[model samples]
Target: MNTEKTSSQPAYEPGGCLTAVARGIALVVVVPVRLVWDALGYCLKHLWRWVLAPLARALGWLIEHLLLIPLRWLWEWLVVPVARALWWLVEHLLLIPLRWLWEWVLRPVARALWWVADLLVVTPIGWLWRHVFAPVGRVVGAALAWAWGIAGRISRAVGRALALVLWHAVGRPLAWAYRVVLTPVGHWLRTYVGRPVAEAARAVRAATREVWRALFGGPR
Candidate 1:
């Protein structure tokens, strides 16, 4: 039997073993380092937003405070007074013709209103008060006096009788009741009658004054 030469596979190289081990170790360290570096980059990318947020806010505040604030301050402290003075000068100087025109335009209406007011409020008030209230007041006084006189006479008669019969204690109360009861009623009647009488007197006085002013003269 011819036996073929059998060759054992070459022994594994030691350097190859070392190189593989080194490559494994390098892979192990490199993977973790790369992972850590990627995580750091992600964290920094996100952290950039948080860092710039406060700086942006601060810059906006600086623009407002440094620029807008001074401008508004100057406007308030200087511009308002200057504007008002210029406006007043223009209104009083340039607007005179307009004022004259406005007044002339309104003059006839104003005169009509003044005449009506004089006739309604002033002339009537003065004339009616001068003539009417006096006479009406006298009439009311006379009526009050009449009622009071009658009441006094009645009370005196009753008092005399009651005193003679030793009932004088009741006389005082009766007299008081007579006065209290009749005074308000009589006054109320006087007020009711006096108001219309006074108004009528005012109308008459006003008419008379007008007629007299027309016929004779306004005043003596």
Candidate 2:
């Protein structure tokens, strides 16, 4: 008799068939891209290291030796000396004399002018403002206040007199007419004419409502 044995373990499942296929495709595509990128990087690295770097260094050295050195020397020797001499000349010849003139002549003249201006303009103006204008303004203000008080008193008195006259002339007569004449007349009219007219109107409305109800079908 021959016997066969079967293993009873679960099979390994790393994702599924789709994931494996996708991984295979990714590897196939990425290998060439990675190889190309590496080759480009290597080439660029060597190119920069050997060719571009040397060229840049040579250019920098040439600039430093030829252009920069000469410019620096010119600035240090020619430009600096010329600038110093010109500054010295300006300071000695022009600025010094101007400074001296300003200190000795212009300053004193300005001071005298200021003193004269103060005496002629500022002092007189200050005096007038303090003595003349201030006193006059105070007096005018006092006069205006007194006149205002007088006017206010006169206005009050006039207003009282007018009120009294109006009360006697117009208000008292109107009050008497309303109280004595119009009150009796209004009461008589309301009693005789208004009551009769109101009663007649009520009768007419009641008759109209009755006629409408007789013609139409509605609640009585």
Cα displacement (angstroms), candidate 1, residue 89, comes to 8.7
Tell me the whole-model lDDT of each prediction, alpha carbons only. Answer: 0.87, 0.96
Per-candidate TM vs. native? 0.30, 0.63
Q: Estimate, for each residue in 1-220, the C-alpha lDDT of model 1 and write its tens digit.
A: 2333334446568899999999999999999999999999998877777877778888999999999999899899889889999999988887976788668867877898999999999998888877998788889999999999999999999998877766557766677877998788889878998888999999999999999999988766
Clashing pairs in 2: none
The parts of candidate 2 lying over 4 Å away from their true place are 1-69, 206-220
The prediction achieving the highest lDDT against the true structure is: 2
TM-score of 2: 0.63
Clashing pairs in 1: none
lDDT of 2 by residue, 133-195 (tens): 999999999999999999999999999999999999999999999999999999999999999
For candidate 1, the TM-score is: 0.30
Q: Which ten residues in a row have the lowest lDDT in candidate 2?
A: 1-10
